[model samples]
Target: MAWMSWTLPTAMFFITIAVILISMTAWQIISPCIERRGFLPLATTRGDRLFIGLLSSAFIHLAFVALTDVNIAVATALCAIWMIVLMRWG
Candidate 1:
């Protein structure tokens, strides 16, 4: 008998959800700073900042994975750092 392993798509589906969850959690933690910076909440005007944050988060995670082969935990941390930097700098 042989054991069946998880497929790549299955792993990717869970990873995608994890990334989104991490991004949303990071956004929530930064919501106050965002408001202080005069950016509207996610409910207002299509959330331009949120969109930009999400895009930057994805890129940061991908780049870290590509360069260092880090696990999801490190990738998430890097994404959070990128989000904070972008919010502060931009």
Candidate 2:
């Protein structure tokens, strides 16, 4: 859309989010998950953990952008790692 700025990084971010959602849907359909407790304070299903991870990662990205002059790639990498850990054992 002309009203929106579709830069490469922005486009990639959205595309990645779409892909993850689609994949997660397929995964749930193939093998359903159950709620379980991890390092997090509450028991949660895979989808719940995913939602939390993504939401928190957004905050992490915003914090990086707002607070530091560091490169965005660093934040992205950190988010990726954090999400993986969260998914595995949140």
Candidate 3:
């Protein structure tokens, strides 16, 4: 896709997503998950929670970038923390 600039950061982002997906799939195969209720309103499986976490993290990053002048690292750190919390007790 020459139309799009495949910069290092962009490439790394996509690679990271691919790696996460692969790892999750392997995890599922090794140990199937049961749907469980957490702080979130509905019972959800690991994959469901992961999807929600990633989607929410996207919004979190967008909000950070749009609403503040702080470094993007702050958003990344927040997203990491939020992901851990969500995966553990969302």
The top-ranked prediction according to lDDT is 2
Candidate closer to the true structure by lDDT (higher is better), 1 or 2:
2
Q: Write candidate 1's Cα lDDT for 22-88 as tens digits.
A: 8767866776333334343433211455567788778877787788866878888777786676555
Local accuracy of candidate 2 as per-residue lDDT tens digits, 1-90: 358889998899799989999999999999999999999999999999999999999999999999999998999899999999999998
Off by over 4 Å in 2: none
What's each prediction's TM-score?
A: 0.42, 0.92, 0.95
Residue pairs whose backbone atoms clash in candidate 3: none
RMSD of 1: 8.0
Better of 1 and 3 by lDDT: 3
**Model 2 weakest lDDT span, ten residues long:** 1-10
What C-alpha lDDT, on a 0 to 100 scale, does residue 34 get in candidate 3?
A: 95
lDDT of 3: 0.95
- 1 or 3, greater by TM-score: 3
Model 1 score (lDDT): 0.66
